[model samples]
Target chain A: EAGVAQSPRYKIIEKRQSVAFWCNPISGHATLYWYQQILGQGPKLLIQFQNNGVVDDSQLPKDRFSAERLKGVDSTLKIQPAKLEDSAVYLCASSLGPEAWETQYFGPGTRLLVL
Target chain B: AQSVSQHNHHVILSEAASLELGCNYSYGGTVNLFWYVQYPGQHLQLLLKYFSGDPLVKGIKGFEAEFIKSKFSFNLRKPSVQWSDTAEYFCAVFSNQGGKLIFGQGTELSVKP
Candidate 1:
């Protein structure tokens, strides 16, 4: 019954530096997703995983961003050589399944600031 | 490409006033619509969702949304708003073929007590 958990509620880094965020999804959830939300904008899906396999990552910046869910319970998203444009909140969410009607549970996002 | 649009960026109203927030999506295929609310300092929570059947779906906290398939619109509404209802609302869509959600820019609602 626990909500999705994320680490390091806020982070600050200089441009070109690297940063990482972690997420622990709800127990028994089978699908996880990472999203980026710029200020005043809606969340944009970065990647999605069903268990340990990636379901979609078409929006992920292959040159700078990467994510992994090794055990299918926890996941990490990393951004290397961060840019000012990467300053945004990173949100993690999970669902019971990949069904379109499944309800998604979101975690408190990690707010990042790139100087 | 799939996209969601929220017409209003911000709105303020006195308590007990009626409320309506417009949302439109661009996708021709069948979709599952959702309305999520984020209170200050909280994570996004599902207000309601529409998959099939009724066009009018009622959710928690007296919130409801009407899904119009022809126009591809899902507008959230409340008959009487309360200050506690102040929050950011997002409209999202998931295609029947995929589980990923496409979200709107969001609407911030402020209800003066």
Candidate 2:
């Protein structure tokens, strides 16, 4: 079985620019998650979607960050007018279900650098 | 707010040496704990998880974690670590009620041959 897939393994942009990332979850997985990992810090959840419906996104900065899971298969996260602090690795993960016992499979991640 | 804490930022050891990594979480309700490892240029992979029942949970690659509810801690341990075990390890917690996973600052482990 193939793992979660993400596009644009890396990107570099100046501050105040906009950027977007794409993610394709593993087949048959029902839950998708997006996380941001700053240097020397653990990955922090940005948003979560369960079959096209948002499960959680309290940590997401609504003013600048937005994400959507279209058709419950692919997801896109966007940051408009990015800041230097937005420089981080964006990781996508998928799980078989939303249950607590389910294990999440992660993608290679998209590293973004905002100058 | 829920949070996970990894006590060590980095650790160095030789092959065949014992390994133990500390993790502590702050949550009053039920939570699911996990340990994830990321090798150089590799994605994050699960090492172990603890849900209920036995406190000692074993995972892939000779790794195990002991969950102590009283202390709100889940610490990863390995009897004998190989050089291949060198990686960044993160401790995470999932809130059963909120349906969110929170990760701690990673601990980078270096093993010498």
Candidate 3:
């Protein structure tokens, strides 16, 4: 089966610029997540969606970061007025369900560079 | 306030050498453990996971992990690592109550032929 899909493997933008990353989860997967991974650090969950409703966004920087999984299949994450600290790889993952034990499959990720 | 910790930031090893990477988590309730690997230019892939019923879990590409609940640790191991094993390994923890997955700072493994 095909894994999760992400667009624009890389992006370079200056601070205060806006950038958006897209993700398409695996077919039939009901749980989708967005994570940020900085250099030398592990991935951190930014948001999670179960179908079209959000399951968690407590870690997301709501002032700059916003994500939506409309129609319950494809999702998009946008960073407005991006900051240097936002330079990281944005990873999208999907699971069969929202259970804690379910395995999550990841995408290649969109690497963003903020100047 | 749950977190995961990986003991090593980087490791250099020769081919055929045994490998072990330490990971520990802090949580007060039942949790699930996972080991994910990302090769150069590739996405993160699941190496192994431990939910219950077994302490020793084997995964793809000759990798394995042992979940020791008492120590709050889940360490990855390989008997003889190959040059292809060079990659970044991340340990993560998930809690039903917390409703989130937490990852440790990854360990970069470099294998010499």
TM-score of each: 0.98, 0.98, 0.98
A9-110: candidate 2 lDDT, tens digit per residue: 999999999999999999999999999999999999999999999998999999999999999999999999899999999999999898888999999999
Please provide TM-scores computed only on chain A for all of the candidate models, following their numbering: 0.99, 0.98, 0.98
The DockQ of predicted model 1 stands at 0.88
Error of 1 at B54 (Å): 0.8
Which regions in candidate 2 have their CA more than 4 angstroms from the true location?
A: none
Q: Which digits, one per residue and each the tens of the lDDT, describe model 1 over residues B29-104? A: 9899999999999999999999999999999999999999899999999999999998999999998655579999
Model 2 lDDT per residue over B1-113, tens place: 88899999999999999999999999979999999999999999998899889999999999999999999999999999999999999999999777878899999999999
Candidate 1 Cα outliers beyond 4 Å, as residue runs: B97-99
DockQ of each: 0.88, 0.90, 0.91
**Would you list the clashing residue pairs of candidate 3?**
none
Strongest candidate by DockQ: 3
TM-score of chain B of 1: 0.97
CAPRI-style grade of the A/B interface in model 2:
high
